[model samples]
Target: MVQCLSHRVELAFKDAMKKAPLYSKVYSLMDELFKFYHKSAKQSAGLKSSFEALNITPCTPTRVGGTRWLGHTLTALNNIWKGYTAIVKHLSQVSVTTGQSATQPKALYLLKLLRSNDVITFAHFLTDVVAVLAQLSKALQKRETCLYEVHQQLLATISNIKKFQTRPGPELRKVQRPDGSFAGESLTGDTTQHSAQMPKLLTALVETLDRRFSDIDEGVLCATKLADMNAWPASLEDSTNG
Candidate 1:
């Protein structure tokens, strides 16, 4: 099974090389994405806060509702749609913005995955995304005095968790500081404390940011070094599956 899949991947790459124009076409198409889809903006875009940009609130992923306000979540890919801006109404639905008939590379790739009885897609990442965005939206609704600071700290903790992978040890301690904040807590104080049971949500945000960092090349963002390094550590899948 592994050998067959490896051969398929090799064929895809070899065919892609032959059709270099096609590969470049797709690669160029993806160029615009990094400009709009940065780690700092993804949660905001996911929350789609233009409607009530100021009054975000705390809620679970199931309770959160802002998927409709952004118009098209895939708006970054404008050329594929022939410049038509269609709003995406559902998350689980296969995208409709790729202006192509049957058997288009991207569209068919997605369709094939959807039809497959046993396969996984990153779309499942959406589930983890909802909780993170919901928490972030709540922060935006109010004055964000410490979110950035806490969020950075959260990333560090996520790194520790990923690195350790919860090595066997004595009973985990509460590990709270004098300030009433959890020892490795990302956001501190009551502002972030009001509804902070969503550690899973925060972890998801960290992982998404990691993916964004993976896309950056020589640390340049429009001639500026956006981030020096990807600090999120190994992914959970690599830590466990590998």
Candidate 2:
């Protein structure tokens, strides 16, 4: 059986990002954050010195080029999600000290977006959804992976996504930061809109999986489990019957 290691995860992630509505805004924020960080580092040693003095290494966002493979997209998403707080902290300082609005309008806009409630919740939502797909993507690429395992993983992923969709309210409300006094930007009328669309996004993800892997046989997936010695039936006839 051929492994369908195509762009299933990539497509799902892309779809989720698209459905988010605010995804482009989040990405733009990351881009501006990195650009401002780089510009600051280059223009004034004070920026770099301050970061070092605080022992917080400045993080830059990785671009998720469509031409690149799935791993690149996952990496880019992870970079922004993981370094979110640090990016916010530095940019907040930059805004205060340098008047980011005059020097870099995009960065200023991004900084505002990052502090907003909708963006925070959406970011958390993406991180949770994409992280599961990322794990499955890595497992599927392994040389020894089998059809049955792929089937199992897909079902598990679908279930997890559905679970996420049902109760995304808390995730879309706030960002938890212990030290920072940053209040999230309120999305006003958008709160309900974002909550409503999450389920549809997850539904699309499930439909994509069903569409892409429809040719995979259930019988074959079941039988492939016998390949594991630990899971073999007691007798040959039992295995065949199952």
Candidate 3:
């Protein structure tokens, strides 16, 4: 009998930025924005208080660690997303008022970058995509998790992805324009192409997940069948001795 110990099904959606420069740019911009916000949140009492008053949670960006779990990236993206408006407002204020500061130019650059329609779309798309990976990572981290449960989680994630493909969910609307408008339909060129390819990416993810886990899936099914008491005799008859 063979029992598969551990397997990692690489999620295709996680690599959406590999061949696409726009996705990479969006990812980098989000991280850079988070670094600025995190620094401000830590150094400025007034900003922290503002966040609290505005009901925004203060958080920092987390990069992908050396471990198999890549949820930290998702978390970082989420934190930036949760504070998108606050970051924009804060950066704008700083860029306008803090002219003598050495970081003023960078702040102004980031402020303009954040206001772009493509950046907004890509950020929303990334947050949504990473969320799926985060759920799977959390499930796989459980101490008592089994292959059966893992399979179930994989299937659930795939279903969710399909749902998103058919009718892209609420994440797309999460990043509102700095002017308080939606950035849904105005995407153009590369960003539009990337966004339109999401369904294909998700479909590939589902296929890859199923292919990678096929062996473990078989093992899970076999184990489940063997564990079913009603499917087997309670006692085996002795052939030679009895």
Q: Output the TM-score of candidate 1.
A: 0.22
Candidate 3: clashing pairs of residues: none
Give candidate 2 misplaced runs (Cα > 4 Å).
Answer: 1-6, 35-47, 66-78, 96-102, 167-190, 218-242
Candidate ranking under lDDT, highest first, comes to 2, 3, 1
Off by over 4 Å in 1: 1-109, 116-121, 137-141, 147-242
Reference-based TM-score of each model: 0.22, 0.70, 0.68
- lDDT by residue (198-240, candidate 2, tens digit) is 6777787777767666655456655775665656688999989
Provide backbone clash counts, one per model: 1, 2, 0
Question: How many backbone clashes can be found in candidate 2?
Answer: 2
Candidate 1 lDDT, 87-161, residue by residue in tens: 111111224534433313433343333322111111222222222333333333444333233334334534543
Winning model by TM-score = 2
**What TM-score should be assigned to candidate 3?**
0.68
In model 3, the worst 10-residue window by lDDT is 1-10
lDDT-best of 1 and 2: 2
lDDT of each: 0.29, 0.61, 0.59
lDDT of 3 at 105: 78
Ordering by TM-score: 2, 3, 1
